[model samples]
Target chain A: MDDKLPGTLPGSRRPGRGPRQAQEIYRATLELLGGGGYDALTVEAVAARSGVNKTTIYRWWPDKDALLGAAIVQSSLLRFDVPDTGTLRGDLSGLVHRLVGLMTGEATSGVVVAALAAVAGRPSLAWLAREFVTDRLAGERAVFDRAVERGELSGSVDPALVLDLLAGAVWSRVMLRQAPVPDDFADEVVKVVLEGCAVRA
Target chain B: MDDKLPGTLPGSRRPGRGPRQAQEIYRATLELLGGGGYDALTVEAVAARSGVNKTTIYRWWPDKDALLGAAIVQSSLLRFDVPDTGTLRGDLSGLVHRLVGLMTGEATSGVVVAALAAVAGRPSLAWLAREFVTDRLAGERAVFDRAVERGELSGSVDPALVLDLLAGAVWSRVMLRQAPVPDDFADEVVKVVLEGCAVRA
Candidate 1:
């Protein structure tokens, strides 16, 4: 019953406060980030564009960094929930499918690219990015933990490396735009990493 | 004897021009890119800082984009000469090693990251990045091609995807700074992509 209550939610807004206002703030934040990136983004601008009081934003987020972090979480940039299929292959395929969607999404991609540039300029933002990436990777790492327990994977396999290869492939393709992420991309990538690309004895 | 001429050199400076001046200009360009991102970079400033005439710069490169492209080439950003080791594994290891070095180098990484940010605002820079990446990938593809002929790789393997994974792993590690690129980082990455992480049947 406690889990059913919105107040008990980990990342949810205050129970009494309306979700609509927060939604507006999040949308405005994404728009500003997309248009100006992080350096140029301001709390006042978000307030003016979002029609929410600056005080309201401050109440939720103590500082601009906090605000940006919350906005990123609220935005669809990190919206994918990790899946837990029985097999390692199924689990990885699900993770890649969700990753491709987030990366290739037009609106989210702009904010992400902008965020990446911002990190180069501001060292503080690196902390935010690391935190976000760590959180996302942790969720994906669980699948490997399951595989190791089931003896599908060797005890020596590093989950972080697996995540890096899977996520990195999609990221490079998305950023380069050399080719579109095909329908079979997730499956092909998973198979290569799992089954090996090279023929061995 | 026909290929022995200085004029036919791969990375040679222009004939009759001193390498010192070219080095100064490239140095100035890199400094500007590091201090301020692409939008903030200008030919006049580079000319003033480099002590090279603005007219000279214009004569050589019609636009700033051209100047940047040349500077990137001259900056040792892509200095890795592709290796032609007999084994596909050896070739890929060499390629990744060079890639890791270029990306982790302080001066080059600064420019590369700034250029990535600049791409978000300026579409033309994206074209330059694509061209650079395509050239790099083509060289790596040759290594794969050699392996195919040697019966080391199946003809069905996709060279592009292989390059993507190899590059993506190093890139993610570099940008995130989760861990240093170890001495054997390249070999490990190539091995994983070549040999499955999961136990075989």
Candidate 2:
């Protein structure tokens, strides 16, 4: 299917000539944003780097913000596919591992973190946040909900909230720049939270 | 005592000397950050606004990064004090509310967000991040550890991991700018994770 196409990989490949052009512009876009922040991700520079005209990029993405957003999508910045390991602990651990890996990876994490950071204040990224996270959360939720249906979770627990809490911690860690994202963090998180660890009266 | 001082209530305070000057500089630091992100925030501007000298700020702090770090010290900028609520639900909710209030507040939130965005490549902010979060986490860890000691949490539960997972979700939500930090999020997080939605084996 067209869905399982190139350019969607972690390294970013191009599809149509237009898609390829977009990818090239996006490459320059990432370099600029990565080298600096949102401010330096200029259309002029991106065009120059891609060897394409500014008019061309503008026609595709409209503005610096749009170009950045498009570049993010085309660049394969976020991979939300939930890892399946069957057990709740395994599932959640897999989820956490995937996230921590994505966040801590050297090549892409910078731009990814920056995307969620200062420039995210721009109105343009707001919709992108919703679209990206919603879909991402939905994917994870399906995994959790399946666990619930299998009676791994209390039937009453909210899947979305569960994912929210899990993702929230990593986001906080990264946002605060507090400490390294531990590899076993996801495993321990699933173990403690899923199994229970509070004083019951 | 120098610690027992007036003009400490933020906006209404008058700038006098010593800590007051620091406060004024911090206040200006926040304002400049709001108007612009990390790049636009200059020590010179902070000095000018606070009616203090750049050398003075440098005397207290090594550089602008340190100055900015000082500005974000354990004051209202970041609330690390978490209470010992007996129940996990109450404890987490209390902590989450405190954090949400701090990170989502009008004045400090912007700086918090911007600082996070800029921290990625700076590397200088690493010390700031550790000093800021470690103490806060220590407080919460004590609370959770108490619960564990009292048989509130299972003996096997790792307090650090729980805290990380809990904080992660809240961080992601805030950084992603996806939704308002709901008051009940922490409570729900505690319940779903601790109680387990799956049918008990």
**Number of the predicted model whose DockQ against the real structure is largest:** 1
Candidate 2: DockQ?
A: 0.49
Q: Which 10-residue span in candidate 2 chain A carries the lowest summed lDDT? A: A5-14
Residue-by-residue lDDT tens digits, candidate 1, A172-201: 777753358889999998988998899786
**Residue A156's lDDT in candidate 1:** 90
Q: Report the error of model 2 at residue B69, Å.
A: 1.6
Q: Which stretches of candidate 1 lie over 4 Å from their true place?
A: A1-23, A74-77, B1-24, B73-77
- Candidate 2 residue lDDT tens string, A1-201: 354432222222334445456567778888788777776778999988889988767655657766665566546555556777777778887887777777778877777766766344554566666656665665677776777777776666766666766676665565455576666667666665675556545
Q: Where does the lowest 10-residue lDDT sum fall in candidate 1 chain B?
A: B3-12
Candidate 2, after superposition: displacement of residue B150 in Å?
A: 3.2
lDDT of 1 by residue, B1-201 (tens): 232211112223333543447667877887788788886789999999999999888766667777776676545544578899899999999888877776767757776667656654554566656656666676678898899899888999998888888888887777743356778788888888999798887
Predicted complex 1: CAPRI docking category:
medium
With a 3 Å backbone cut-off (N, CA, C), the pairs that clash in candidate 1 are none
